[model samples]
Target: MKKLIFLLLAFLAACTSTETKKATSGSAVIINETVVASAMERIKTSQPGVDQTLLEKGIRHAASLWREEDGNPSDFIEFVKANYISDPVRRKEIFTKISNYMESVNGHFNDITLDLKKNLDEAAGEIDQIDQMYGNYSVGSHLSDDFFSNKIAFAIALNFPYYPLAEKEKLGPGWSREEWAMARLGDLFVSRVPANLNQALNTALGNCDMYIAEYNICMGKLRNEEGKQLFPDDMVLLSHWNLRDELKANYANKENGIEKQEMIATVMERIINQDIPEVVINDPDYEWYPFSNKVMQNGKAIEAAREPDTRYDLIVKTFRAMKDIDPYNPEMNTAMMRKFSWEMEISQEE
Candidate 1:
């Protein structure tokens, strides 16, 4: 997910800034222009030959489109239907246009809250019906918005297919623009401010704790507690494990400014390095297991194709490492290999 990548980017930047402007003196807003600049530089440096001029053009077009269709509710629906029948090239162009509304240069964090508040209302109205029919509604900042199908911003999030799509082109898992922004703030904005986190392990743990709390608050605000939650249980659990593991891995490399990385690692060790692995999303062996009996028994273990993700090789290695740490744990060692083989079998049959 881009949200996770953003966090990793922040971790990589590791430029802890303390530029805060005080309103009354008790607290201050740390809109570190230096941090933003540095972060942007890091991103550009990593992307190799990404066309800056082209990206800007794309973002501007998308914002213009949203602005033009601003008042109408049905516009997005028509927009989605158009995409459903679209070929890859068309889809790319459409999303390139949509990307403008969310480009980092335009102002990644400015008025972000207001932007989401406005868009959430639009998303809520559009996604409710889609959710009822497709099993993936209520996935955006708004209660009814199905972000996965609504905009290119959310669509690109499927850069790594988190799950194996069942039927026709289905939605993937991730936070919406608003959700992504909020999490970015927690990861980049809040963590950079002068705090105890950069000093000692406890302080670092404190920062992680603060991040987790802030994350919950953001979630609570964006996804109302009493509202109907639509994300699949297994998917949600996977996100939890993933976020936990990411934090752990990020914290593990404590050179330079990564002193706080251990706190996350400490917490995750509690989660994963347990006596008995716990079930995630009804699948007890989901996180720990290397094989799925269903897949193995079906003989898909020998033939299922590996799923696509952020980086196919990297994902496989991560799973392999998980398996390696406890080679005796068959769940860890053989789950993905078997499951992937099975998936291939089903695909061929269809």
Candidate 2:
């Protein structure tokens, strides 16, 4: 279930706002304060009795996302004038329409992804390179770009401006259901990452998932001191989740539980340090003594190669992929910041 969730997240991460041709960071303020004030005043003059604070916030937010292709300051003012909604009834109707459209788009894309990932996620026979490619491919990757190109994203941003996490935490209790939904919708187009970068991140995470899925420890082959197997024959567990779960379960076993726990710990340490025998990993042909890090095959001890830091290599690959996205995200420049502040809606200190 965790693996499936990870896979799903990897696919969804590819659906961020599409990159602009300029390649500037989203954090850079494109519209100046003068233009923002002018746009806000123009909207106020056009629509009498409009909420001044919300109008300014919405105009500024929309202007921040405007690019060279999106037109100049005069065009931006015109866009705000045209798209800004002052009437409550009309605003609600538009919000509902946008919500329904987004739901349909997201649902169909998710269905397509699930179908593509079936072979990789399920025990549906041998997985080919094509399966991996399809599983890693994100159908919604270009949705952001298309929306921005058509000015749909800008329209949404203009009316439904985003609130900071701190601001939300403070005022969320007083917000209505529609307000909450609008806030979430505002979050959809905060930054524009390139489609290629999103695809690279998806591939990196998918490769990590594949590596972990195939990493199984043959517990029946793990021999302790005095040449005894603690686990039953044919007992196999995936590392490190299953291995950790089995170790926790052994705590109830008063007899030989400590020995089993120690053996599992040793196995974990070997895995972390990249000294685990290559032949013992997902291979039942060799007998492994975790305590001494020894490998024996058919009653004869043999020199076995270590895992060559493949674990760390994959981790680095995923890290680099995330790092490549940092410059595009002005608010959350680092991956950790995005995970905690943007995704988790909390600070690491909290």
Candidate 3:
């Protein structure tokens, strides 16, 4: 039976892996090599003494992001011709303007997000279902689509092409402040993840956050094997960070320190195994004995059901949400790859 179960699990794993690869493999490359080549040649011919390397990289990167909705080959060619800055002074001026504009746009978006998340993140007041919905709504979710529609993204991509982490590490030392800023600016608009997917991802993560925020263990209601309360009546701790911290702090309590740590360890184990009583979480009305896995209420023992794998369910939902975004990001298709290569500027192999 165990062998058969193992084989079944392996089959499922293979199926999931195959699905992920299939999803990511279909990232549409609409702009063919011929279009890219023609666009580069036309721009170079039109503007004499232009930087050959920049011209090639910028045009190719812009072409990689262009879609049918953006326009035809001729339209792309015209855009490159019109937007590619050849003169050093003119390029700097344009860079400054774009930088300022992006700063303002990003700043306002951040302000809006903070305001939206105020009730969720803080202990200001009671959070309703509407508050959760508002918190999950991402104001900047459609920003990428809007930028693409306005041709601002294309303009930025044409002027400032993205550099991979390895390339940036190699060329970073000699670059001036302005050049560094331009390279950073080029990092935007590399992917075209849809707004709906972005919102879904946000909601999934927000739900997880809310679950964690509400996961408080009433320490005051905990009892040891002898039915003795070790903690104060008002003590409460949130798992798993606060619980771990409390365990660490208890090491200094020479008296019953090991006992407290053992109880805390038992609580953590129960949480991980999903054997924690659902009623005991965030409820001070019940007394829980971690060592015996028993619960009592109103001075009498009572029956309670264990948590029904809600923690693991939330985790799987978040993972699938992140995976849904993989197709839009052709270069860093996986969330792990994006975290290491794009966000952290470090390759996964390292």
Per lDDT, the best of the predicted structures is 3
Candidate 2, residue 173: lDDT: 99
TM-scores of the candidates in the order shown: 0.17, 0.90, 0.91
- In angstroms, what RMSD does candidate 1 have relative to the true structure? 26.0
Candidate 1 lDDT for residue 347: 33
RMSD of each: 26.0, 6.2, 3.1
Model 1 residue runs over 4 Å out of place are 1-80, 104-107, 110-350
> How many angstroms is residue 241 displaced in model 1 relative to the true structure, after the best TM-score fit?
22
Candidate 2, residues 154-203, lDDT tens digits: the string is 99989988787877889899999988998898898877676778888889
Candidate 2 lDDT trough over 10 residues, lowest sum: 14-23
Those runs of model 3 whose alpha carbons end farther than 4 Å from true positions after fitting are 1-26
What's the ranking of the predictions by lDDT, best on top?
3, 2, 1
Q: Spell out the clash pairs found in candidate 2.
A: none
Candidate 3 TM-score versus the reference: 0.91
Error of 3 at 343 (Å): 1.9
Per-residue lDDT for 1-350 in model 1, tens only? 67976786466334323321121131222323343234334434554554554333222222222322222324433332233312435545645554464464335443453343342223344433333222211122231122322454323321211222231123213546643333222111110111221122223322333222222111111111223222223332223445455445554454522432333343243333221222221232222222121112121223323322323233333333322222221222233443442233233221
The whole-model lDDT of each prediction reads: 0.30, 0.85, 0.87
